[model samples]
Target: MNHPLYGYSLCAALALMLFFGIYFLTARTPDKPIFSNYLRSRRIMGVALLVLAANYLVHLLCELRFSHPDQAIFLNLSTYYLSAWLFSSALTSLLDRNYLCRNRFLRHILGWLLFTGVSAVVLLLMPAGIPQFIGLLIMAIWFFVYAFRLARRLVRTYRKAVRIVDDFHSDHIAAYIRWLSIFTYWAVVYGVGCGVLTFLPKRYVFLWVLSSIPFYIYLFCSYMNYLLFYEQVERILESEMECKPDTNLPDSEDTAPIGHLTIPPKLTLWLNGHGFTQPGLTIEELAEELGTNRTYLADYIKTTYHTSFREWITMLRLEYAKSMLVKHPEQTVSWISEASGFLSQSHFTRIFTEKESCTPARWRKLKD
Candidate 1:
């Protein structure tokens, strides 16, 4: 191996693995179910990153053992093991966030066994360069199929979450899932490129290998940035949860019948009378204040406003925000965002733009 580029690539992979490992260790445990999934997905991705680094290390060892026939055989076996392990780890991390799957653990285990078995068989049977192409082809097919399924499930999940809360919690989780799906899709594409390059002429193979190093390094950095963004969103969620008071209610309320409860007109009066302007206000809190079960209140909002509790609250906030913008043009967007019960300016801006077909600034300017 005359390629100095290989050494630099290996070093870069190792460095990224170390950084992600530290981040995985330091990341706080999530308090909510959505964030719990996020943390779990990140943990799995970290394991995948470590496996990738190990594969690179094994490749380095294989290169060093070229002169020693006996050692080369052993290193070659190690390379095969690491390669199969890397593929399995990557697939697991990519699919672990598919919350819509039932019996996920069993499915994941079966997938791991099947893929690993296929990879090992191909590596053992085919000529060295040929197996990579076949393996990557299989990987690419599986990734696209799985990613499509995951994307569909994520859309359904997001719709449900939107009905539950209009806040960033659901949106954050959906964004995380979308990013993971895209990452998996691109990862397979990269693997396919690497496999294709393996069939190139021996002289060109060196260049192919050299080029792959920076791509892997770039992937590692991108994932690290994604994790950092995920962590920041988690912190925002934690603060939002902390600010809201816990309402002790029966677990059965989740499935309780809300058809019998009479929703007083006072409920609307209370919401519009500056009650909806409280930051981080949740359905349960509003239900408690209304002296009704949370399910009943949710149903009431759904029936009366033809929207979910979250949507109703969001609408109220938007109306309040519009009035504030018209009356107090001097207030900054950030100030108005908070004053209108939004958790962050970004969230406010996103919703406002979606509803108004323009950004908050543009909408305000038009209204003025």
Candidate 2:
């Protein structure tokens, strides 16, 4: 692969592996309810990514050949609308909760409609040929807007899931939120660059090379850092949770309020029991399983564990995911995420990076 194109191909490969990893894991497990829905969404998104990759590759390959540039390029440009449509579908899947069994006809129409709307806006404002460089810039802007909006929704959903008084994991929940924030900022920066590139002359277009290199380098370094420090810890923690003593309870402050001291033995059993089976259990549902009220549970979590229930569940999930990744190397991170309890591959990616400080791909690579 050519050097410049190779960089993107690497991303494409990573995305592809991520898709299948989730698929294999989901197929093998066949029981994670929460993750089942996410699996459907991710499959949709993954196909879209493949579409985007193919479109980009076609354009790049045609450009390098410099033969029938106009015709080849025109063919490539046609895919842009399709690529954008796919991208919109992918984003919509990410934003939606419980996408499995969703109305396929509705989804297809939504994606196509979104693509048409965006294309119409672009057409009305710009001339033909549209400058490949400038077009990329516009697309980046679209990406950033969607990324930030999605981040906000995730944060809100997570917070809503947390309880104030229960024993919960803080690090894992915080990590999820932080990762989303970082990605949001990343999107903003990419958008800013796109805006900047709009005015640059053709000769100075190579400046994009200089700008993008640093961003990619940062992403690579972040991946490395996450694998070394956090990924290892999360794996260990997950294993402990999976096999956690069903009867033995972690010590909490006895002097703690009724909410705090209310740690039910049945809940421990429930946690361990489900640890063996359930995929994608939420804190609210978990609280219900324990026969506790959500608000009281929140107070118990806040007073006894000094964290929210959401955080605690995330910690449990991460701990389990990490263990699965290490114990079942053949299994993809997506499988572990489903088995451990996450909403989607995007959610899993954000949390894993936040908690483990590395992408699942980087973590697996390190173990290899």
Candidate 3:
């Protein structure tokens, strides 16, 4: 507690929590499926985040509680934090059930025991060496056994559904999900790093805390890229893909670049140029730029690409934004939104929530 970095670290942690709370609560629409499904699970995860926030707040209180001998407040808060941490395993299990890893009642119970009990026991047993090490070990095992399978399923879905993109509304949902995978990886790395740093003494705390700065930078850059891409989407339409006024027909599988599929030269070249200039293009704008009506563009996108224009653009924007957010956390969300070519902050916020499954601000803060 005597460490000079303690205050800075505590403040940073608080900022992270506040940022996430605001982003999650405000980002999504009431009708969104992501906001609906797994309500219990969402609450559980939210509790965990809140508890962690409380834990940090308690740490600050502890530093100020010397005058009151009856001050058990911080201690109780710590208990709640740990308890919530334990419950988080079950929540995670439930979340996974919707994805590649099917969750059975038995498996969830066992996972809870392993994550909360066995893991805790191991940490207490080897206080200095085993906590983060064991955490990392368990995470590695979990990924290979459970998370990896889920990822494979997603990839399979992405590849198999290429033709169904236009007809399927699920493609947009899936696309948002795909981009989150990148954050998931970063979360694991940061979680492990944070745990390791926890065992260090006061003086060295800055070194440990400062480790997260790079992650913040990643956040900023990724958001900027997303903003830029969306802004250019409209202007670059015809160059990116061809449109026909005919029935949603099966696409030609020509020999062309892997990213572009067998797309027409006009469309392929536009995409290759990293989207049309303007830096603020969107689906509507792209349609206007191509002189292709929205109905035509939507039809072509649905039939040829097997997805909606919004979904397609969202997927592209979200991925680019995620990369920018990860790389440039210093930038504000407003900056990121503008750079991404969003019409307004509200639009960016809404679309980001609908498409990415999380707010841009929250996603970036979680990386911390």
Candidate 4:
């Protein structure tokens, strides 16, 4: 608080955290029943953010109250350590509640308390320089360890989320998380910088703390963009609910399941009729076209085809593209990609290279 810049920064952080806390708490949760857990997560996360803001507020207050504010260093570091753990939980909640379930949250609280208790003895009782140095070293180590651990969890959870979307959808859910990758990379940098600043003077720490205002702003924006993907997830859930199987009688499709994902007669006919050559061929759309339901179609594709609905559709598109390449030598690859149901030539080429181990242009040349 002695420094005007530091005072302004703390006030700014307080406001940012307050805004984020309220947004997460009051934001409209997904209306779909399947997302109840996610809604619960948001509420818990909002509380965590508010707690973090309180940490900043305490710092500001202590700096103002005590002529020798360093007398309150223990209080400052203790609350920050507490807020640090909660902050990780808050971000994890944004990803998935399961990552920090009740058992996990309790375990984290216990560990934080145990560590804080032991460190308090050092900070409060030990001689001057020893306490500051050792306390900081301990806090820095803990912060780095947990921050790295949470970063890994974020990446893993994000990848799984993308996979889940692709498992059932052929939409552009991949786009939702593309910018999220930028945020993840920035988070790693922020963690490293903050951990280092833990050892530095308060001035440098305040400067870095100020960085969090924009960091979180960018992060929240990217996260909100993910709601578009959630909408698709809600649709899938709705389809599952509406198309739930009946126990009254066995499903005729279940009785005589196709072997090895043999294209069912109807799908075979549809394929022959070039139904797979249309862009945005989601499983729900395919099910509707087949006069079936989404759940049954998803199960059929997953169990028999040994691939996700997204990959299955992509494979079909590539096959169609290959044939088109062979027959229409003059047509551009871009034209073939769009004609064969891909979003773009680049997307088509990427998938082709991944699946075929050659570029579409090279493949066409070899075929010619």
Candidate 5:
């Protein structure tokens, strides 16, 4: 093969296929109802990986055989088909969360698939130069625009979902979506570059194939990262559901009489009594401690406090840290962070800055 890395590329494709095949087969049965979207997304990713692998294998075989003109045409058609299929799968997975009404979401997915199918057919019938390039350019532009919009929506959905589940953080989900958007943008750029390369001399074709190898490696790695991330999120959700709240407590020495507070008296008592300052405190755990279900507790926090459980907890921790800084001016930020029940000083500083409009150190300095 003219492409020096052809064999290595095929091997990588095979490895990707094997890995996703195993993942698809061995994906754990979701223990909770909320993981349905997660499972569905994983299945979609598996299918996309499978198609991508097959596309690479076919390209390798075509190059090795020095395919006939008719075979080359068929290969071009197959490439468009597989690329469109994979793109559709990726977009569908991004929108698969319960963010939209089920009927509306399904309709949108169906429409996308139908449009991609038709575009692939049209591209297959078009001649192999300017016409194909135009079709690819249009599709690439559409994908980039749609992926950008979907990424934003996914971030919002992640934030709303995290409000009810303590272990779920919007950071990971946002990062994943951000990476996916970046990958999609680069994929379109590469597709356009390759289309332009086709118009050049035959010798430049090898360079095009070489450039594509990196993208294939990136795609493989990204898919693997996504799979691992899905598993991690699922594990956290399951553990959160199964964990029992820490209920053993010593009797209060001086019960602070509850004044007329809009917040639930029990919840307020728990917060002032230092329950909110406990490390790794989840809404579910707090709910169990207060003799309520997770949903009711989440609703109570949202409706009564006009904030999510996470923000409310952070508020409590921030107040505690402020008091500590005032009382113990000798304490380091790390010590204060630990004492305030934050996971790390960096996290503590980030929350403090977001809420206080200054870094922890600056806040402390101003206080002094």
Candidate 6:
């Protein structure tokens, strides 16, 4: 109670949570579905921010009023558990807007409230001995269960999103997924740490409050960054398809036989003419250019190239870069990466090294 760090950290956390709560809660977004979904997710920050800020405020009040602030321990545990749930819900919306729209989400919250409400009763009723410890232990275990579920779900979402994104875009999409992966790992770590620390002696809860600053900041930054990236990608896709009919929409013609939709001859010619070297090229754009459907183009690439559209394009780009490396040894890797249709030179080098087991510069020198 007398610790200087406790007061400072409590004040800092209160300010931050209130600020973030108001900012994200009131932040305006476009009317589009994608933007609206993100707005919904960001708004979760407001609820969580308010709950967590209130918890900290209570802690502050207790510390100031009580000669001993022992009763404030439950605040940290409850805040951590509920905050994790809110964080997971926000991310779940971004990945799948339809997820948890049913009874499961409600059940989970009800279960948390039930257990937490019980634990609080036990803690306040019991005379600060074994019974209180038992209550804390149960709360910690309950958190572990929920944390495990969230960790598993996050991993599953990461894997599926990576697969879909990599197969859909032939550009710098790796950067989007990389950040997602980092955030996923950090969320798991933060959850597990909080769960374990929840059972620790209440005197050490200043650590929990201090640690929360980074957790919330990192999550907010990551979510906003991802949302911005998603918006940029959406704008690019929209611009590419602007003024063109949305041919991919389902219709009776869509189910019609695709047998006559053999790979277009122009596809081969286009590939040979450096068509795949266009940065940010998508299967839809290529299909539109070829006067074919993305389905046919994707199937053709899968069958003939024995790879996804993205992988086929990437391999073609790699070959182009390799040839350029040999033919024009003086040209920089950056230039070759751009000419070869990569959105980023670092991305080019990463893919090149992954395939060849050597960097572009070394591969060029070795081929000499």
Best by lDDT: 6
For residues 193-232, write the lDDT of model 2, one tens digit per residue.
7457635654454454345445434433443343333332
Better of 2 and 3 by TM-score: 2
- Sorting all predicted structures by lDDT, with the top scorer first, yields 6, 4, 5, 1, 2, 3
TM-score per candidate, chains pooled: 0.62, 0.41, 0.39, 0.69, 0.59, 0.81
Q: Which stretches of candidate 4 lie over 4 Å from their true place?
A: 29-35, 64-100, 130-132, 178-185, 201-203, 234-258, 261-270, 283-312, 315-368
> Going through the candidates in order, what is the number of backbone clashes in each?
0, 20, 42, 0, 0, 0
TM-score of 2: 0.41
Residue 106, model 3: lDDT of 57
Model 2, global lDDT:
0.50
What is the per-residue lDDT of model 3 for residues 228-278, given as tens digits with 9 covering 90 to 100?
332222123222334334345434544112323323455666655546323
Error of 4 at 281 (Å): 3.1
Worst-scoring 10-residue span by lDDT in model 3: 230-239
Instruction: Tell me how far candidate 1 lies from the true structure as C-alpha RMSD in angstroms.
Output: 7.1
lDDT of residue 295 for candidate 2: 44
Q: Put down candidate 4 lDDT per residue, 1-368, tens digits, no spaces.
A: 47777778889999998998899889996677756655665566677678768777876776632454444445555565665566556555544544666788788789778776766766666667975777767865775676577667777766766666676666555566566557667867876776566567656657866988998787567557666565555455445444546565345765535422444777889989988777777776887888775556777778768888888888888899999999999999999999998888998899899999999999988887
Best by TM-score: 6
True-structure lDDT of candidate 4: 0.70
> Clashing residue pairs in candidate 5, if any?
none
- Tens digits of per-residue lDDT for model 1 on 147-198? 4454455445434433334443212234543544454456556555664665
Model 6 CA deviation exceeding 4 Å by range: 30-34, 64-73, 100-105, 126-135, 198-204, 232-261, 264-266, 299-307
lDDT (Cα atoms) of all candidates against the true structure: 0.58, 0.50, 0.48, 0.70, 0.60, 0.74
Q: Cα lDDT for residue 242, model 5?
A: 52
Greater-lDDT candidate between 2 and 5: 5
